[model samples]
Target: MGAEAILEKIRKNAEEEAAALAKQGEEKAEAAAGKIRADAEAEAAAILGNARQRAEELEKRERLMAGLQIRKNTLAARRAVMDEAFSLAGEQLADLPKERWEALITRLLLEAAETGAEIMEVPAADREKYEWTPEGNLPIIGEKSFFKRLNAALKESGREGKLTLADAPANVTGGFRLMGPVYDVDASFDALLSQAREDWEQEIYRILYPKDE
Candidate 1:
């Protein structure tokens, strides 16, 4: 009712309104800060999870590559061993004794004689190394005499036995060749060993790398 009292009442009401506004502003600020903090925490967790997943994938890929490299190296080493084994076989066959060499050739000719009329060609090395006859025995053409003997052997095996000799030396290391009209039989030691290597690879592998038994 008094002017002073009315002014004081208005002042108190204004003070209360200002305090309420201040409290509301502080609460809103706190809520916004809490939301920002939660968002930041979630983003950090997501980044950490993604990093861990990428690391695991990279580690798995490295392990697979490492295994593949080891297998590749192992295969290369095994191939080297097989190659050496065949090389040694060729050497041994080439170094057979004279009697054994002749016997082997005779056997090969007998086995390979489809029609024994195929032209027989000797390797340059064989022509040089073969002991065709007894030293100083009788036949002046010792090579010819040896060929006649081969013909006899062929005839005994129920073949044509008329294989003519070739003028040029055969393209071979050891053993002999029989050239027919259609195809030729390569009885060269190198050729025989090459074929044998293919046929015996599995057997050789079994010997080289045995199972648990």
Candidate 2:
């Protein structure tokens, strides 16, 4: 329910507890002898004071809890928005047009290439999409072929066009990974987005929540 409703419920409960304490004090004061009644009256006053203090504490505690709940909810909502922002970015990457997608992937592949002879491992679906023929062989020399573009990029980058495709597909999408002799460079969409998230999270948050609200 709403915070107001919760607060109102807590208010009623505290008031009821205070009323019960006041009634008990009244009963003790009424059943005492004259002198004893004076002592009982004083004790009753102390009891009422305690009840007021306890009620105030209960209100404070409830308010604190309500405040915490609100903060938790706000943070959860903000996180949801942040997650959606990243998800949309990934979706945009996935939905890139063929030529555009190839160009983007080619750029990443070129940048990630160290020796230019690394095995390019892409997902099986990507292999079919790029028409990667038997054992890393390019189907034909054409601008449409992604493999030929890789060789062109490698040559342009002052490296041998010895880059070959892995026989087995990589568990990746939107990009490929370079398996070098000593290391590997992941250029998959997941990896790219993950890194981008880490690097640009604060910047994106600033744009999303201008006041940091």
Best by TM-score: 1
lDDT tens digits by residue: candidate 2, 43-133: 9999999999999999999999999999999889988998898889889988998778888988898789888888888888777656554
Backbone Cα, N, C clashes tallied per candidate:
0, 0
Clashing pairs in 2: none
Quantify all predictions' global Cα lDDT against the true fold. 0.82, 0.84
RMSD of each predicted structure: 3.5, 21.6
By summed lDDT, which 10 consecutive residues of candidate 1 come out lowest? 127-136
Residues 139-199, candidate 1: write the lDDT tens digits: 3436546677788888888888888878799988778888887888889888888899889
lDDT of model 2 at position 32: 57
Candidate 2 lDDT score at position 84: 94
